[model samples]
Target: MMEFTHTASFNGHCTTLPLSSNNVTLDPTVKDKWGRPALRTTFMNHPDDIATMKFFMERSMELMDAAGAIKKVGSYAENGQTGGVHLLGTCRMGNDPATSVVDRYNRSHDVPNLFMVDGGSMVTSGRGQPTMTIMALAFRAADHLIQAARRGEV
Candidate 1:
């Protein structure tokens, strides 16, 4: 007698549209222990995002059927995303201070000495992992900072 086991899984990711309403703000009524306003996050999935999640679920089911799986189970948020997995696109990067938080080099537009080289500086979340991209941005920002320091710009 012989025994064998096989398993497969599929995970799909979708790019979310940016909305001004989805943002982090300081809570006017809530204060932290340090006397600063507490951070309040407002987020809701767009209609397109919900549709994309449904599409991915359907595709995953099809793939499972095509693989002749004996049993399969899949689920997605029917209403909207309840929680976030990858936290990206918080501090958007752009050339204009009026529209974005960070500049092209990941430097804070409002604060000259502050640099944001993490996922928060991304303008949009990619459909894949952002680790490598964040690393690259950090390296680039570091290089720019070094050059700026050399020029006595800091």
Candidate 2:
């Protein structure tokens, strides 16, 4: 009997550009029970994302073959891969209000007092482990908010 293990790398930079792609719109025809317009998403994977996944899958198969596997069956493509636990980039952070929802400090551009300290503030999806980064960002935002409050800057 031969042992087989399957694993995947969780590293892909497939976010929409700040000014383009993945445009979200309020569906005027579709409404919830509360009579509020539902959000419609237009998301597509970047070409680079597909390429990277293909490369990783090929490498993994090569490794498996080297390990004396008699039969190997693996595919990164031809099968849907919804491989993300941490959804990111809903509200991106940037310096400009025209492109970003939040600023560098995770503060809303429209509302100075409103701070968004979460994964939504991330501009990129990051490499799989986003919890730690989110926590750090939260701490950083908290510290900044506290200092701003102390200085009467809201």
**Best by the lDDT measure:** 1
Candidates' lDDT values, in order?
0.86, 0.72
lDDT of 1 at 106: 96
Best by TM-score: 1
Q: Residues 1-154, candidate 2, lDDT per residue (tens digit)?
A: 5343543333333332333475577997999789999998766666666676777777778777777666666666424346546677778889999988899889999999899888887756544567898898888889999999999999
TM-score of each: 0.89, 0.81
lDDT of 1 at 149: 98
Model 1 scores a TM of: 0.89
